[model samples]
Target: MSRNAEHDHSLVMGLDFGTDSVRALVVDAATGEELAGEVAYYRRWSAGMYCDPAENRFRQHPLDYIEGMEAAVRGALAKLPPGAAARVVGIGVDTTGSTPAPVDVHGRPLALLPEFSENPNAMFILWKDHTAVEEAGEINHAARHWGGTDFTKYVGGVYSSEWFWAKILHVLRHDEDVRSAAFSWVEQCDWIPALLTGTEDPRRIKRSRCAAGHKAMWHEDWGGLPPEEFLVHIDPLLQGLPGRLYTATYTADKPAGRLTPAWAERLGLPPGIPVAVGAVDAHVGAVGGGITPGVLVKIMGTSTCDIMVVPKEKIGTKLISGICGQVDGSVIPGLIGLEAGQSAYGDVYAWFKELLSWPLKALLPESSLVNRETGEKLRRELEDDLLRRLSEEAAWIPAGSTGLLALDWLNGRRTPYADQTLKGAVVGLTLGSTAPKVFRALVEATAFGSKAINEHLMKEGLEIREVIALGGIARKNDFVMQVLADVLDMPIKVAAADQACALGAAMFGAVAAGLYPKVEEAQKKMGRGFSQAYTPDPEKAATYQNLYKDYLNLGKMLEAAWSSAGEATPLR
Candidate 1:
């Protein structure tokens, strides 16, 4: 048989619920060949429903997930060959972490009910949302003083606004309707699988080990989540919530349950097919990118999620500080998955792009130079090509040539101490500075942020042997990749698969379906190798080393200024 013919085999579907959209990827189970995929953007989210950028509040209705999933699956299936849908043996799911929603006793999101349908507090609190900053700070303080188990220890000794408990607490305290109606909270990652498998009871939902351990402070050492005593101490509003939530969590490789007949019919798939327990996208993406011991797999997209695995025996009893979390079996079974990242990466570029497009946004619709429709089309054309054009020009400028310096904290810092209250800064701007120069500084700032994460890991005694890159920014942006290599002084390889997170989900799906004995075996067979490699330039690396010190110094100065003035308050 030809290579194409040989690729035909039993298929698995990987559904990735990203911030803006859901992606459905179909892959050959035996060979890891990517056959078809489709992307479905959430209509409500695209139109800016239930989000306030100024307030740092981002929410997504459960209907968006349901619609995106069904649409993406059906669209992807349409692109596959004959009988391909019938050959699908398993399905896997991944979603953004810490994206939890208030749910009723029946395990349905509160936003799904008529009364709470339009309430932003009832929707899924997006992972990037920072509305819970005060709540996170309160939890952090109480964990240290409550005279109980320190639930924040495993999660870098700090609770973040962008996590499970803090978001729920924020909603409960602020919104009376949601507070009274919410019987339990469910992470988007865990809830999706439960939705597919027809699990109605919140207690029966198979919680994700990745989501629980990393964000919700679930630990076997602590028996489960932080005790009721500790929670009530933090806030009396949290009383009895733990018992209503969950006591156990399952890894992504395990099956949550078989797909229910109703969902199977809706998705055009076989009933009783295994549905792997859901996990955060970055953990699953790390697996898809072939992450191994000491390999730092960076999922660089809207934000950056840095993932590395260490053997349980090697990392036993040692907690790494100033990261997202280190969870056992979060990425791969029987290993310790360590996650750290920036709260903003590509979003920084997008922010700059939006800033530059203000003239068009302000002037275009009212222009007499063209028809309104024509003006809109031209405006979009320029906006869409803005980043690519900026990157091309920026690449020509030598390192540190532009005197401008930037801090990659537009969406707050996620690692080396997670601080959502910190705002982004751009300093040392001169009259000679151009758009491209400012853009270059922003790109370099993001790269510097990544290096800080790597250095922090090494400082904490976790060795980084190699760096693997995946996600949209990694695959599509060579200029950014080269800058990252120079900043980190390490070679980076991009994963071959375009939809690596989805592909990783499919690997777990294969294991859940009993096609592979373990996740490692599935990865060995299905993993697509690296497509491109970026090597650090010695001259550029030396220049960046000096610039990095300046970056750190500036950060400290700004932090001190904010601390003294008490100006770094969270957006309300």
Candidate 2:
């Protein structure tokens, strides 16, 4: 196959490895037109299994990711033109952040080892895993006592249980086999490329600065990794791990390497096709959605990740506290990437649905016409119709009609106040309240949570000029988006593409192939999308503002109650 010139419209592939599945998109390098795409669900036995609440553990098999990758690539290729695969110039990958995999010296997962096959600690820790809450608390205490010299500043002021070190500490303290057998702790963002290329060198594995700085306690001012002395305070094993794990060369647009000959052939593509360093799904979604400087891109789904880019000039020496991370060139070159998020969004709806206790007969009234196999179908149909109707009815009840306010701490807060120990709460519910009213309260609560984050950003001099919303929830839930807009009193720009993260990864492929000079450049050229601006309604905004004040007062009251009673506060 002959290589096309830089301006030629060759095909580029962007593969997004999400928490549930891997999605791939083949796009035209010049026009950003999506030529083909595919999604492959993970087939692991314990794909979505969460460990005990006390431990906060979550695990996934490495084989599941590998299988999903292969399946997505094959599925995408099948939809492309017969000769397009050969013409593909580069590929890029993005994944859920803070997901860590324990690997041996050869980059193979420790779970694959005979001795550690059954050990869950040897498997990949999903980003949502909070098993290391205790360990994270210890790290936070140490960082504060250490006088801000630690690298924890990069990640809002405290290390999260969701990150690499905390999970590693949890496993090391609990699982002897995993601790003894693990040679390295790798980020999922880096591991995918390492697995494809079959290399274990620190130089070979492209660690995304977006993930490292945001989730692994890395800062450029302190030369990337945390100080050795600080790591020693947290855990003696992490002392020397920093030296081995540190990397200075962090650029999102740079090509990490080329596809290995074996992988290329297996996937029906040419060898030496450029592969860009991996990125966080939300960060890449910003690039893919064409959110440039001053724009906040909200990648909303199970959770919502708010991403923004700022020029180096705007970021003064003052460290912006209470955010996911601010890494230079992590999203676009010469810019700082800032991330904030809600730990729960759409999950709240799912949780409510699961808690609904409906009689089987009531849910399946047409049982005579529907067989046992189709009973589930009928139940789902009824449930969906009811939910939709409830949503519509809830919209008519007016803001604050329920005489209730809620704290969206169901899954804990991910930004501004990055606390995971908090629990959800609802106050002022009366006997007259219905399920739809409660549901509306929950939806409003999430919007208020977003408003809190936005307020914090504005206070910190990070002017959020516009919001670009993307992901499944943003597309499916108009009520949620409109409520959010009203609560924040800002226009919400929804992305046109349903799979913005996957498309964003594909944009990186265009940059790696030299089709564009930067990720943003590629986005402008090929990233297709229109923003649906939901102008805030003045009346609704006023009502929400009053309710938000009540919500804040409720938060304080709850905190005081928890303290006085010596009980844990609900809503982290």
Candidate 3:
């Protein structure tokens, strides 16, 4: 089929770079139809590549980003009908954050160079990496009394180890080679779009408001970023970094740049296709979940990110404290996107599943399950279908009947207090407790965390009129959704789009490409609808009220332990 340059409409491409894989989607820009899509797993990442889980160190090579992007985009494009590629006029991107990397003066991720090829210090720091725990604490300590203004005020009162500067500080402190070679740091979300458009010059690449405001402490009040004085106080190494970094942050509503000849040829696309500025996956997922004013959208995957948008006028003088951030035009062009979430949602559940199944493999021989065909089937059921079966049985158990409660902090807490040092806890466990019973308590703990976030938002003067759930857990697990509804006493709507994050990105692409005048217009026409709504049961809600109090008590006890351990009093 011959490519037609005149064909400027009907399709747009959206790329979402997640922790495990990168997903590419081709969508009907006018109708919000998901025409074709594919996911490309990072081959290196799948092999436990560049990661030290024991040390909470996770890194992704820039090669993984390039390879995943080309593979997924080509794979998705190949699935489309004839002439679909020519119809593509715009591209959008979203990625996990604050996944940042130290870069050369040319804006190339240091890991991309031959000298730094095998250096973990040169790689993009994964959002889950907690290698900067001490640096984050130091930042919090310094920012609290950083002379005139507290730079950490906008980002939940407490600085987190999982953010931009913290990881940079960690690398600077530990890796002398990296510190000497690195001129600046760049977020994954910001770098990808710039890379596609061949805007590798450090001063030319457009930075994303979604990433900068939420993770990098960029605000207009004191100019672009937290003053150099504040950063210097945290660490003298950060002296000239901010000046080398970014001054202005742009929202995704605008185009970062057009695709370059090299990237276009590599990805089989037109050279001039508009590329929208990058954003965090959850913020765009909010758009795909039909996010509007007062609607809370939860992107529940490995982690959970809660998103909501409100007008600037509606949030006049009141600061929505204790959130990831409130960034203007992050989700919508004319609104503010508020973010808050648990660091580990589905991750916490996955941890329990592994903990419960370890004995089944270690104590009993795997050969026993493989000996007979039926035994193999039983083993498969135990390994793969465990979560489903547990959830089913847990549904039968009454609220608080488990007599066991768990803290959903296996990784750490993200919002209400962004504490990365908190550990998980299980209380009232007896020999009689079964895996299913304990699983029920774990689910309740996650729901309770969501409730706390909602309460915090309300306390900060934001009214949540609606709740929308998106991502893998929200779609496949009806039991979890129902329980979440019961706990919050709020109706929850599951987004219809299978690739909601990518779809939201497509909406931004449409606007940036000039197919739509504004993001709201693009979203209104191209965004997916609701698939299902979960309503709270009155009885379950009442029972959860009492259980929530116990949860509070348990949380207080845990917080006290942190305090005794010499941590600062949490602001949650």
Candidate 4:
């Protein structure tokens, strides 16, 4: 535990590729003390304009990821001491998963070619982009009809638009160029490493067990991926997709390959430094937050992902429905990793802010007059005032006070029911309702959503002994966390680290660099965090119970209406 620079021997870099930016963290491999970090925001572009609202399609140039990664790494390296660069032993990357990008035989992005540069099909299809709903529905129907035990058991009963194969099929059927040029439809989590090593071998592309199990429907008992027949039944073009899928999917700590000479030279790292395979941002965040088995780790951001690790023996037969996936060794070895989530959280907050019609000019001056002198001081004062007022108003309203309940489907449902066609709704809102009241109800609605998933997990025989919350929203917003605690009737433990995802990535880097023998060991040594647990208030809990009952009834009522109208029927 020497703090002196002369005694520092081990260092690693963790790179996180998020939705809007790439972040790099340089850390002490042995101590997990963050030494330096940097962030590079993706440059927004409207140059091609291929994202059609009518079609629900969204795409991004692959070059954005490349440029963003380089910038982030270079910027972070600049922050480190001159000698620290050479001491960096390994690199690890974590990214939002199931974001598929089409590439050629040489591992070159098809979108980089001039002819396909403007084509949406050639670019990366983000996980949130739900344009493939139709394709996903078809896959689900076909899987059900086939009744394959292997396929149904592994994927928790349905394929989703937020996965690799579904997105690939959608593009292939709609764009002839994509079908012809897509030598491989790769996941972003895997592709980043492939790009770094300059290798396109399907064998060489190391898939994270986390992504493959949760998103791509890979499992151990079935070996890897669904049988070839299942793929053919879904789409003729997918006949050989299984073979193209990675054979030796690895854990987050496993080294995929050494950095290529070009990447090493460009990033100021050793050429042969080991690079761990990519992982889901949320899963890595769990490791970073110091969560062990039976502790549900909620990575709350624009979206929220709930991750838990459990002994294989504890996976009882409550039908464990609604969970995204339960893959063995996906997070920690000798345990089953469970993933469940809500598609929206902080994004809903952003939406509410956007809906506020007041101009900044009008609000800023009044906000400053109320408390501050300088512009920065005024802005901080205003934000504090607004958040405090909102929280107070929200707290005053009883759990069922608004007499309104909402479905947290602003981004679509991800767990317990993986329905993308589902839309958000707020029922029992009257003309007398105010914006703060509505906003409070919306917050409660998300809490209810989390409760639903928790119940599903309980039913599946996994006893959630504890709840650990991590991410900006969890740490910054006390009101939301308290609401969640009341709704779940369980104490919520918030992680101390501001950058849980980055810290988790660094832990993986430590293992890859051989500073630690395994991921669990690295996690124990490197993960540093204090937990803030919120005990449920009996009065609030009682109120939420009644409100939750009403919410369930309303949900059923809405479903019946949709069924009666035949709106729930398949489009095709």
User: Largest TM-score belongs to which candidate?
Assistant: 1
**Tens-digit per-residue lDDT, 457-526, candidate 2:** 8787888888889888777777888999999999988888757888888788778777777666677777
lDDT of 3 by residue, 48-71 (tens): 889998898999998998999999
Total clashing pairs for each candidate: 0, 5, 0, 1
Q: lDDT per model, in order?
A: 0.92, 0.78, 0.87, 0.78
TM-score of each: 0.97, 0.93, 0.95, 0.90
lDDT of 4 by residue, 208-252 (tens): 888888888887667788778888988898877677667668898
| Residue range 444-511, candidate 1, lDDT tens digits | 99999999999989989998999999999998989999999999999999999999999999999988
lDDT, model 4, position 555: 62
Residue pairs with clashing backbones, model 3: none
Which parts of model 4 are misplaced by more than 4 Å? 1-8, 45-55, 316-319, 357-389, 563-572
Candidate closest to the true structure, highest lDDT: 1
Output the better candidate (2/3) by TM-score. Answer: 3
